[model samples]
Target: MKTRKIRILIHVAVLGLLIASCSAEDGATGPIGPAGPQGEQGTAGADGADGADGADGADGEQGDQGDTGTANVIYSDWIDSEFDANITDPAAGIDLDAPGLTQEIIDQGTVLVYGRNIVLPSNEIFPLPQIISNDNHGFRVNSPENIRLTISSLNGAAVGSRVIEDYRYILIPGGQPAGGTTIVIGSKASKQEIPDYSKMSYQEIMEFFGIEE
Candidate 1:
């Protein structure tokens, strides 16, 4: 009876040992599982503030002044003339009133006289000291009072009254400056090279002085 009881106890102890050994040994790993669904995207951040504006650039330089113009010139309208038969000695002379022709002007300024004959079809303009046919036409300055116009015969012929019909004069404020000096008259400056007014034609003189015809 004692041996049978001991055998039963030994069999029970061996079964318990086998069950513990089986639990201690690990089994082979299984295949990986399928991935889960992706999460929702986060909301975007607010926009940043705008940057400041740039400064303006610097200003440009100024330009130079222009040259002066001829504004000190004085002129006169056409004056009528008729030769007197009574004054007929050396030449036929006529005196015209010229109150503005001062002696200072005759010395330091310029005075130009021109003659025109209306009888001719072309109304020819002639600078004083001009000769027509056998007649010599000229002018002499009788300063501070009058200017004298004379007609002399070259061939000893009688001086006629039909020579000159009208006369005009231009008074420029400045004359030929001495020693290439600049002449300034009442805010007006004269050119260094004064023009030879006698050499210039009537039309050229009018255009140069900006005189209206």
Candidate 2:
């Protein structure tokens, strides 16, 4: 038969080229990879926002002045005394009619006026004894009814029953005698503020203060 059918087709074409050269080639090269364990830190990247404000400065200057002070005073020396002339008020007389009095509190001392032919108000307060004798050296006028004496004896003259020509006096102001010898007032206080014996004539009031004889 034609050469045994061409030797069985060349033994089935060399067994199909040995099953296509034993299933062909793609697959070889893998040994370099051992450096990788530090990769779990990839989750930290989120924060940044805020900034704006600045401008203002100017004004300063003024200071100076201080100096001036001094004070000193002196008057040291003067004194002498004698007492017993603070008598008034055998009854309520003298009243200045609402004027408490102020010569800086009547010059703080001595104010003796007894009303006789009046004339004192400027040295407004000091030696004011127009007259009030009994020679106890008399001095009375402080805190009475302040002017309201409905005459007791203008024509007959009296001390105890108000009206020696409408009364007047003064002894207050620590009541006399802090020191003496200043008793010589205005022309002996206008010739002894009346009392040549109420303007004399009882024989010139027994010859002016010589009392009797």
Candidate 3:
């Protein structure tokens, strides 16, 4: 036989090399081999804790009382009191009628003034009287007689000099028409009208009202 046909062609070439190595993974999958280079980005997550405070809006409607700017005059909020005497013949005023002051409101022609100061605990610093309308007569806005401050004259004051005169005021109602004003004096002047208390000499009118013995 030729050696039995060379062992049947060497067993058919070893069974065709074991059927091409037993492959069933088709050849079309070879094109997907180029996609290998995308894996490096994972670190950004930390900011979530701030949201709880929103509910407060509803209360606005109470307006309707305008046009009294300076309201004719009345800004007395520093009515300090204390006068150990020395302000001759009239020592009982500083009572702006409980702040609503009325002598029919200074005879209805209003124009009061007093930012006085005569301190002396040995600190000695007198000369702060400002009772308008006249000086020497000291003070006078005593309408209808009810202690409406008729301080007549502190220009002769001297009850021994343990001195301690403190006062405050600013009332100017009575038609205001003297030009330019902003109404100030509790804060000490800016709103004009109420300047005329001159006339010195009772020791310069008691050092001009701040008095001293």
The RMSD of every model to the true structure, in order and in angstroms, is 13.8, 27.6, 15.8
lDDT tens digits, residue span 1-213, model 3: 999999999999999998887777643454556778999999999999988555666445555533324534453544555443554433444444435655655554344344444443454322234343333313455543222333444454432332334444445455333333323333222334432323222244333333323
**Every candidate's lDDT:** 0.73, 0.34, 0.45
Clashes of 3: 8
Query: If ranked by TM-score, best first, what sequence of candidates would result?
Result: 1, 3, 2
Each candidate structure's count of clashing pairs: 0, 11, 8
- Which model, 1 or 2, shows the larger lDDT? 1
Clashing residue pairs in candidate 1 are none
Candidate ranking under lDDT, highest first, comes to 1, 3, 2
How high is the lDDT of residue 106 in model 1?
73
Best by TM-score: 1
Tens digit of per-residue lDDT, candidate 2, span 22-128? 66373355589999888787888887665433344433333333221111111111111121123234333322442443343344443333333224332121122
Output the better candidate (1/3) by TM-score: 1
Worst 10 residues of 1 by lDDT: 183-192
Give the residue spans of candidate 3 off by over 4 A. 1-10, 20-99, 102-128, 131-147, 151-213
State which candidate, 1 or 3, has the greater lDDT. Answer: 1
Model 3 lDDT-worst window of ten: 193-202
